[model samples]
Target: MKKSSFILMSMLLVFTMFVAGCGKSENNNASGETPKTETETPKESEAPKKDVSLRVFSTFGGTDTAREAFQAALDEFTSKNPNIKVENDTMSANDDGFRTKVNTDMTSGNEPDLLFYFVGADAKGFVDAGKVVPLNDILDSDSTWKSGFSPAALENVRQKDGNIYAVPLTGFYEGLFVNKKIFEDNKLELPTDWDKMKTAVQTLSKKGIIPLAAPFDQSHYVIEHFILSAAGSKGHNSGLADGIDPNWEKGYAAMKELYDLGAFPKDAATIDLGMASNYYGEGKAAMILEGSWAMGNWKDPAVLDNTTVIPFPAMPGGVGTGKDVIGGFGSGFYLSKSTFDNADKKDAAIALLKHMTSPAVIEKIALANGGTPAAAGVEIKGKTQTATEGFAMVANADSVNNPIDTMVAPETFSTLRAGVQAVVTGKKTPADVLKEAKDIEDANKK
Candidate 1:
C-alpha cells in the first residue's frame, strides 16, 4: 500500500511539471517571445508594400536636349526605385501653352506630384496660391544638397518674401551667334563694335547672305538683346518699370537701321524661330542673335564647327559696353504641396526631387544642353567652340540682367513684344512704339 501511494504521488508531481511547461510555452507564444535558435532569424512580414504612383509635369518635351537629359535621369531613378512609378506629363519647352495647362490644373486643385517651370514672377501666382511646397526645409535638412548650388543660383529662385520655392537647374545667357566660315570666306572682320556690326550687315546683305536670321513674328530674343545692349542692366531694370526709356528709342532706331539695311531675312515678319534657326544652321544667315538654349539646334557638324558667339556690340551712348548679359537661373523645379503632404509617398517624392537636382544630374543636363549649370563647381567639358564663346561671354560679363519680359507684368510684356515687332516691321516708329508701351505700363500701374 505504501509503494502504491509513492507511485501515485510521483505521477502527480510529473503531471504538475508538464502543466507548468505547457503554461510557460503558451505564455511565450502569447508574448511573442519565441525562443530563437542559433541558426534562426526573425521573419519579415510577408505582406507586400503598397505600390506608389507619382504624377510629374515638365515643360521639357519634344526634341529638346533638356527633355532627353531629364528623361535619362528619370529612367535612372526608376531603375533604382522599382516600386515607385512615375507618370510624366510633358509639353513643349518653349510653348506658352504649358503654363496655361499648369495654371488650369492648379486652379482646379489637380496639381501634379512634381512640376518643372519658371521661377520668379512667373511662378508667384502658384506659390501664392499655396500650391507649391516651400523648399527651405528640405534644403536646410540636407547640407550636402544645399551646398551643391551657388548662392546666386539660390537667390535667383527666392521669392520677394525671402523664401526659396524652387530648385534651379540651369543658368542662361543671350548673345550674338555668328557663322565664322561665312565671315572668313567673305573676307569680312568679325564685328566688335557698333560700326563694325553695321558694316558687316551692309557687306553681308550685298553678298546676298541674310545678315541676321531674325524671327520677329514669334520671338522677342533679338529685340530683348538690342534693348539690353542699348539700355544696359541699370537702364533696363529701371527703365522698363518706369515706362519706356529714351534708351529703348535708341535701341529701336538701331533695329530700324538694320531692317533698312536688309540685315534680316526677307520673310522675317512671317517666319518663326524654327525657320530662323534653320537659316542659321544651314549657313544661309551670317549671324543670329539668340540665347544659349539655341546652341543645341545647331547640330550640323559644319554649323557647329563654324559657329562663334559674342555679346552684341555696345550702342553709341548706351549704358553698357557690350559686357552686360541677360542671364540667370530662370527655370527650376517646383514641388507639389499635395505630394509633399501625402504620408504614403512624401519620402519617395522628396528622394526623387533630390535625385533630379543633384550635382551629377545638373552637370549631365548642362553638358547635354550647353547651358551654365546652376550647381556650383560643375564644369561642362568638350564644349563646341560656339559654346566656349558663349561661356566666355557670361564669364566676362560685368553685369547680368533678367529679360524684360521676365521682369515685367504679363500685360506689359505683351505690349512690349507687340510694339517691338511693329517697330521692326516698319508698322510703327520707335517713338510711337515707346508711347504705346508707356501707356500700357501706366495703365497697369493704375
Candidate 2:
C-alpha cells in the first residue's frame, strides 16, 4: 500500500510541472510573435511636429504696453496650438523705421508673414509686389470674421484695388483730452465752438498752464490734429480724402489760427506726442490735441484720473461738425506668400491666425489692454479711461479721414514732417506749410 501511494504522489507532481512548463512556453510564443515595442512603432506620433512658425514684423512699438498685451495674447495662442508658433522679428512704432523695413524687405522678397503697414500707397505697393494677400476670401468664408468688425473698420483696410490688406484694433479720432477738474476749477464750461475753445485756452494760460499740449517732434500726430481741426473749420467730412481731390481747398487757414493762438507749450516745436502726453498726464497742460490712443495711457495709475476727451472744438461754418474723426484702420496678422505656399506651415499658420483673432481672443486682447477691436462684434472687455473715450469718439463721428502721411507717396511723409516743423518753429507760416504740401502733392499727381 505504501509503495502504491508514493508512486501516485510522484505522478501528480510530474503532471503539475508539465502544465506549468506548457503555460510558460505559450506565454513566450505570444510575446515573441510581435516584437514591435511601443518605441518601435511608426514614429509619426513622436516626431517633433514640423516646427510651424510664422514670422511677424509690425509697426507697433515693442516698448509700448499695447505691444506687450498683444504679445501675451500671442503666447496664449501658441500654448493652445502646439503645432504653430509666431516669431515677432521687428517692431517700428512710427512711420520712418516702419517704411524702411517694409521697402527693404518687400523688395528683397524677405517679407514677414504679417506686418503693420499704411492703407493707401503702402497697401498698393504690397499688392504690386505680389506680397499682401487679399483677406476677402477669409472674410467671406468665416461668418465670425465678417460679422465681428464694424464697416468703418473694414473700409480702412480696403485698397483702391478692392483688396483687403489689414485690419485695425482701434478706431482713432482726433480730439481734445482735457483735465475736467482743471476746467471746472477755473469755472470754465466745456468748449463747444472755436471761439469758446480759444477763450478757454487764454483763460487756462493765465493760470500758468499751457492751454493745450501739442507735440511737434512727431509730425504725424500734429498733422492729423491740424487736418481734423481744419476739416471742422471747412465743414469737410473726410478731410484726408478731400485733400486728395484736386478741387479741394484743404484746411490751411484754420490751421493758421491754432498756430497763432499760442495754444501749445513753449517748446512745442520739439515736443513729440509722447512728451505731450506726459505733459497732459502730469497736469503741465490743461489739454492735448491727440487721438484715441491717449486714453490708453490714462489707465496707468501714474496718470491723473480726472481727464475727459472731446472732439476738436466745432468750427462755425466748417463742413466737418464735431462728429468727424481723423484716423486710419487697425492692423491685422499677415501671412507671407511664401508661408502660404508651404503645406504644413500654411495649415498651421492659418489655424493659429484664426485662433488668435477669434471672438474670444479679440475680446480678451481689447479688454486686457485698453484697446478697440479690429474683429467685428467682439465687445471691448476692460474699460480703460482712454479706450472708453476713444470708442465714444468713434461712435459720435460722422466721417473718418485717413492720415495724410498714409495717403501720400513715399518720402512725402518726410516732406510733410518738415513742413510741420517749419510752422511750429515759426520758420514757415501756416500758408507756407500748406503750399509746400500742395506742391508735393501736385508733383505726385502730375
- What TM-score against the true fold does each predicted structure earn? 0.90, 0.79
lDDT of 2 by residue, 156-234 (tens): 7777678776655554456677788778889888776778787887788777788878756565655665555555533
Backbone clashes under 3 angstroms, per model: 0, 16
RMSD of each: 3.2, 6.7
Taken over the whole model, the C-alpha lDDT of each candidate is 0.82, 0.65
**Distance (Å) between predicted and true CA of 331, model 2?**
2.8
Give the range of the ten consecutive residues with the poorest summed lDDT in model 2.
239-248
What's the C-alpha lDDT at position 351 in model 2? 71
